[model samples]
Target: MKVLISGASVAGPVLAHWLHRYGFEPTIVERTPELRHGLGGHAVDLFSSAAEVTRWMGCWDAIDAARTRIDSMTMERFGRRPVEVDLSRMYAGISSSHVEILRGELTRILYDASRDTAEYIFGDSIASLSDDGSGVDVTFDSGTQRRFDLVIGADGLHSNVRRLAFGPEEPLRRWLGGYLAVFSMPDIFDVGNHTLAHLSVDKLVGIYGVHQTGQTRSGFLFRTPHELRYDYRDKDEQKALLVKEFSNYGWRVPQLLEHLESAEDFYFDSIAQITLDTWSKGRIGLVGDAGYCPGPAVGGGTSLAVMTAYVLARELAAARSDLASGLKSYERIIRPLVDQSRRIGPKLMGTIIPGSPLALRLMPFAAATLAKLPTAMQRFIWSQNAVGKTLSSVNLVQPQVSQSVA
Candidate 1:
């Protein structure tokens, strides 16, 4: 069977890998000109199950070697003293014990491993999808057309394929009442050797050491109750909005915005979650953030993508190419994980960022009480991080196909 995937990032490449292993041809289409560039050394943790998937895929070593090594972190409120949280205590309730690696490194390694197996068409997206229930006829923005047995939307929050296959994202999107913008800056502070300094009041800014490179990456998170005025496609306008919101703020933010001027990889978007009633319809299915992104705050996106692709391909192969039954089975088991990941966003945001003055006043007390909190209370607070909750592959019960199509 021939499969066409909409995204080339986390989930799409993963689906391609599994599809290949299952003996089905998968073709991936990406909107980006190439595998993305200029990302911060953000770490990704996979619950043991997701880890096993990567181990089987054989990119785990490269990811581990390229990980960002941060010695420690300090959280401070402006005009107040900084407090250090215990590392083990800080990571206490988290899911993956395998440690965190940058998102870019994970994607790069996955892309390389799958390149020989899957055909990737870069710098374009599907112009239209003409599905006749028998198969999908896809037209590319570059004016090419093709047909495939299945089409999967692994695109992120703002998924074009989701709209084409399912419906508009409006009914499915839930805004978490915040905006996050991240961009690269030259190592102006000469931050050396470790990822350090986390500051949060109602917002957060951090400088992290990127692997062995002398440069550091800065994260700027801005909180807003109302939507801001800016075009997502207009980089200039987006930069202006970022500048306006953060110009008066301190702690090396001004310098970070300086790099925002010329940085081609600057990303500005609302901290939003995508929740859909159904992940699959007909021969088309939604995976990863397109189907269920609990937002970046949950820190389980990469893991979810890996698991999603694995389950999807497994269901497909097990169903003997009966797309409908397989998609339903895939959605039934995956939704519970998606629901858990979804609930994580607002809970983490409520604690992580004190959105109101009253909440802000309560944070330090909460922090101080954190050490004193009973094991039960501590567990409750840490539960929001979405750790140790990833659904693994072998756990999925594959349905047998009475009728073989593949």
Candidate 2:
């Protein structure tokens, strides 16, 4: 069987890897010119099962070597003193096996692991897709046309393939009443090995510098009840909107905005979640953010991406000639976890960036209290949380190939 996948970031590569291992041919088309490396993005966490999946794919050692090494997090409220929270101890409460790595590093690792086995077509995108019972006929932006047994969209939130396969995103999207912007800049503040965050009612500005990389990543997030009107593809307009929203903010926001002018990899997006009725339609399917994204840059999105791809490939291998059965099984096994993970962002929104002064004042107090809890008690508390249940629930049995489809 031949499978064509869109977006080569996290889920696409993992799907390609497992499909190849299970005796299927997979090709990936990525819109970006090449794999992103060293270009800064926020850090992502992989729970126990997701981290195990990386080791299963043979990328854990490389990922571990490239992991971000922040020792602590400092939270500051403009008029108040800063409160320091120990990250190492806090993470222990969630899971003893949680792994933290930058988004770019994880993408690079996944790409490297799959490049040898999968054919990657960069610098182009799927222009159109038509599934006529037997297979999906794909047309690329470069005017190339091809047919594959199945098509998967592992693209991020604004998935081109999803738009083509499932119609518009607005209906499937649930905006979390917030927007997030992230960009890299020089470590001017010299916040060496420490993560710094300034919070206010409805606003948060965070900066963290990696000593090994000699670069800092700054992120801004603020809440808005209604959607802002703008072209998603317009970089200049996006930056301008960010400037307009954050121009008068305190902390190092002024400098952060100044650096945004020249930042090569500036990214801005609404903190939204994608919930679909079904992840597959006929021979076409959606994976990762394209299908069931809880919330971008928060919760277990990266972990969910890895887990979903693994489940999808395993189900496909098990149900060899039956695409419908395979897709149904894949969705059935993964949907519960997706539902639980989707709750993390909305539940923590007020805690992360309060909507009122009282909540803002209590944010640090909450963190300090959490940090002070005994490791075992913290672990128990976290295990009871939605994110914890979602993380602990993923247990993928390695798929055994019934026959060679290669």
Candidate 3:
């Protein structure tokens, strides 16, 4: 069977890797001109199950070696003294096997693992997908056309496959009442391997060092009463909006904004969830954030993406000749996990970006107190929460199908 996967970030590469291993011919079409390798992107967490998936792919060591060694954080509020939080201990509490690595690094590792096995086409994207009952005929923006037994959209929140297969993103998206912006800047603060954050009601500004590039990433997350109007693809408009939102806000924000104009990889998006009831329609299927994103930043999207892509591959392999059955089985297996994951983003948004003044004060205090707790005690506390339960809930079954080329 020939499987066509869209996007090459986390899920696309992971799915391609497993599909190839499971005896399917997988081809990945990535919009980026080249693979997004190195330590350029934002830091993302991989919990126990996601780590296990990486281990299964023999990429765990590489991922661990590339982890962001940010072990501690300093959180400052206007009136209160700065609070110190042991981030390493906090991550330990979240899962027994957890690593925080840059998104780009993780993608590079996954891509490397699958590149030799699966066919890769960069600087191109799916222009249209024609899914008949038996197969999918795909047309690329580069004017290339191909036919595949199956089509999977492993693209992120704004997925081209999802839009082409289902509908426009606006109706299917649920805004989590906030916006997130991130940009790379010089290491002006000179804080190495330590995160610095300024918190206030309805907003947060953070700067963390990227050791590989000798640069820092500044992130701004702020809540809006309603969705803001701007082109999703317009960086200048997005930067201007970010500046307008934080203009009066004092701290290191002014300095952060100074680098915004020149920042090449500036990213801006609403912290929203994709609320699609069904991930599949005919021969085309959706995986990861393409179908159901809990929310960016606050949600454990990286882990969710990794685990789901792996499950999709396993289920598809198991289905063998009955590919539709495989897609349904994949959906059924992940539905419970997906439903639970949806609850995390809203709760985390409330905690991370305080909605009120009291929350602003209490949030940092709670984090500091939690960091001070014993590792075991912290683990117990996290295990009782929605996030921990969700992270540990991924239970993958071994593929029943034989490993033979299709």
Best by lDDT: 3
Q: Give the range of the ten consecutive residues with the poorest summed lDDT in model 2.
A: 397-406
- For model 2, residues 171-265, the per-residue Cα lDDT tens digits are 99998888888888899999888899999999999999866668888988888767898888899999999998999996789888889989988
**What's each prediction's TM-score?**
0.89, 0.97, 0.98
Q: Which should have the higher lDDT, number 1 or number 3?
A: 3
lDDT of each: 0.73, 0.87, 0.91
Q: Per-residue lDDT for 1-406 in model 3, tens only?
A: 9999998999999999899888999999999899877766788899989898898889999999998889999999998899999998888877889999988899999999999999999999999999888899999999988999999999899999999989999999999999999989999999789899999999999999888888998989999998998998999999999999999999888888889999888889999999999999888999999999999898899999999999999989878878899999999999988988999999999999999999998998799889888889998898888898898776875455456644
lDDT of 1 by residue, 1-406 (tens): 8999998878998889888888888899999898863354355666556766777778778766776666455566667776654434434333334546667777788888899999999999998998889999999999999999999999888888899877877788888877776666667876664444544556777776665557677776667868676666787888898888878887777777778788756777777888788988788889998888777744377787888788888878878758888889889878777877777678767766677667666665566557555555666666544543433323643333232246
Clashing pairs in 2: none
| Candidate 1 lDDT | 0.73
Scored by Cα lDDT, where does model 2 land?
0.87
Model 2 C-alpha RMSD to native? 1.5
Index of the highest-TM-score prediction: 3
